[model samples]
Target: MNILAIESSCDDTSAAVLAPTGVLSNVIASQSIHIKFGGVVPELASRAHQTTISQTVAQALDESKLTLDAIDLVAVTQGPGLMGSLLVGLCFAKGLALANHIPLVGVNHMDAHIYANFIDESPSFPFICLTVSGGHTQLVHVKAPFEHEILGSTRDDAAGEAFDKIGKILGLSYPAGPVMDKLSKEGDAKFHKFPQALLKEGLDFSFSGLKTSALYYTQAKEDAWVQEHLNDICASVSEAITEVLIKKLKRAVQQTGVETIAIAGGVSANSMLRAKAKKMADTMSLNLHIPKLSYCTDNAAMIAITGKMKAELGEYADMNMKPFASL
Candidate 1:
């Protein structure tokens, strides 16, 4: 069966076609407008989705050599995103499904991130997945292909949010994780040691204190010195954040006894995090699974693949399902 999917949860507008074997085509059109504001504006993002969704879907179908009529199922991210953005994609999917007489499935954005690992390669069941993104930080125990129990999550700001917050202090643009990750390689990571807050037991995390620490440290520093050692500051902050994540992941893996470890979500695209995860996995004698850089971020192909998996498992949402802003 062929599935067509749409994703417009935040700043990116993406679409993809998925077959039983794998992704046939995936197209993404990211809005550069958010760069100027140093963050995503919900209204502007929703407007951009309205303008880009059709073209994105068309491109995916065209590139895959398939037509909308040939699509057996229509899937779209329904929640845990901006309400306006989610509405655009959900409405479009509903309309398309009604017009084409195909089934419409609502996919969770976080679930899609986990399924992204299954796109190119297949990881066995009962694995531990650490999903870190701009809006979420979670350690989920995957007992089966579609079965997951969230063992831990961030109580305050997520890892990506901390990166972007620190980026603002460093005078970087929005979506600053990538920029911070890049600059870290050029500077000394030990220049500044930020605090890592290990919240009340379990695998849950809290980065708000870390973010606040960076803010106050930057504020207390001399303007001239801050300018001179910007790279070092970025590197130090990134290193601290990565260390906290790795430390928590190790604890979770040991507690769960799941030897296979996987990382997903936007922040998983970080070079330092991936390298550290691989190193830790090897040292601990655990299997590691991470998606390619392109699939690390939000996209519709992941949603389509996840929907396909659900469909095969006889999990289908009724038409009464609605969008949610949070999980």
Candidate 2:
């Protein structure tokens, strides 16, 4: 089956064509206008989607050498994102589906991140998945292809949120995770020590305190010192965040006895996180599944693949389906 997918849950306007086998073309159009603002502006993001969706979809189809008429299913992200951004994709998808007389599938943004691991590799069922993104941090047990159980998650801000907050305190722009990751590679990881929030009992995480600590730590630095040690600060902060995540993930693996583990979402693209995860997986004698960088961030290929999996299980959303702001 050929699926046409749209993703506009945030600042990225993405579209893709996926065959039954895998992704044919995944095209993402990012909005750089938010760079100056240091964060995403919801209204502006919506407008950018409206302007870019058609062209983006067209590019995907063209690159895949397919036409809208060839699309057997139209899939779109439905929730856990900006409402305006969601609506733009949802409405566009609905219109396309209606015009082409194809099946329309509504996909959850978070769920898509989990399915991203399946894009290139065949992961067995009953594995543990750690999904860490800008908006979410969760440990899920994948009992089946489409069935999942949330074992743990963040109680406050997510891990990626902490990175962004720390970046802002250091005068970085919006979407700071990648920037921080790049800067961190040039400095010493042990330069500074930040507190790691280890919740008492469960696998749940808390990054709010860590973010606050970074804020205060940076504020106390002399202006000259901060300017000179910016790279060290970034390296130290990223190292602390990675350590916390790796520690909790190791605990989850040991407790659940799940040997096959996967990491998903935007944060999964972090080089340090990937290196540490690989090391831990090796030490624990477990298999680790991490998606390609292109599949890590928000994109439509993941949504299309997820919808296809759900559709195979007799899951479908009707025209009455409504977009949600949160899960």
Candidate 3:
């Protein structure tokens, strides 16, 4: 069986082919246009998706050594993302399914992130997943295949959002999360302590306060000083954000008593967060699973694999299905 999937939930336009054993081919075409804006522009993102979607899918199929007729299932991200971007992917996917007479599966963007861990590994049932990304930060308890209960989520800014927003204050490039993470590796995480919001609160998170604090802190400093201490400042910001995430994960483990755990979504690729998760897993004698860097972000492979899972359960979406923009 061949499953072709498309993911255009945000900036990048990606497509993938999933063979029975695993992903046969994964192709991504990222939009560099948003760099100057220092953030994603919805109109630009949708236009980019429309421009790249066809070529991207063709490349994925070509890489997989499969023709459009060979694909048996078509999957697409249905929502919890930019509406225009989601529509671009969905329209393409629906066309493929209709033209080929193949089955269609519309997957949730967040659900695909969790299933990304499944692509490389099979974590035990009832594990905990801490999914942190630019648009969302959530802790989920996965009891079984396709069965999940959200334990907690960000009430304000997500962890990744905080990273990028704070990075912008530091005069970093757009999509500053990766830049900051790289810079943080060489600096001291204790250089300046940033506040951890809702530390004692339940599983819910709040990074808005942290962002505000960073804004004020940087506003008071000279641009020269901030640039000189860029690495240290990034490290300190990372420390503050990750500390809270780890704390919440620990609390979730204590409350749920789940011995198996994992992290997913874009921010799961953070070096500091990954290292901290590893240490915690080792210290707690827990089985830990994390997706490779490719799978950590929005990609079609996760959507493909998730579509395959749904196909196995006889789940299918009809042509009447529509894309949504909320989680």
Q: Give the per-residue lDDT digits (tens) of candidate 2, residues 80-113.
A: 8999999999999998888878998899999999
Total clashing pairs for each candidate: 0, 0, 0
What order do you get sorting by TM-score, best first?
A: 3, 2, 1
lDDT of 3 by residue, 127-210 (tens): 999999999999999999889999999999999999999999889998999999999999899999999988999999999998
Better of 1 and 3 by TM-score: 3
Q: How close is candidate 3 to the true structure, as a TM-score?
A: 0.99
Which scores better on lDDT, 2 or 3?
3
TM-score of each: 0.96, 0.97, 0.99
Query: Which digits, one per residue and each the tens of the lDDT, describe model 1 over residues 1-327?
Result: 899999988889999999877789989999988888888999999999999999999999999999988999988998899999998888888888888898878889999999899988888778999999999999999999868899899999999999998898778888899999988888898998899788336788999998899889989989799879888998898888888889889998889898899999999999889999999999999989999988999999999988888878777766676788884
lDDT of each: 0.90, 0.90, 0.95
What is the Å distance of residue 275 in model 2 from its true position?
0.5
- Alpha-carbon deviation at 154 in model 3, angstroms: 0.4
Model 1: pairs clashing at backbone N, Cα or C within 3 Å: none
Error of 2 at 13 (Å): 0.7
Residue 259 shift from truth in candidate 3, angstroms:
1.1
**TM-score, cand. 1:** 0.96
Candidate of highest TM-score: 3
User: What root-mean-square deviation over C-alphas does model 1 reach?
Assistant: 1.4
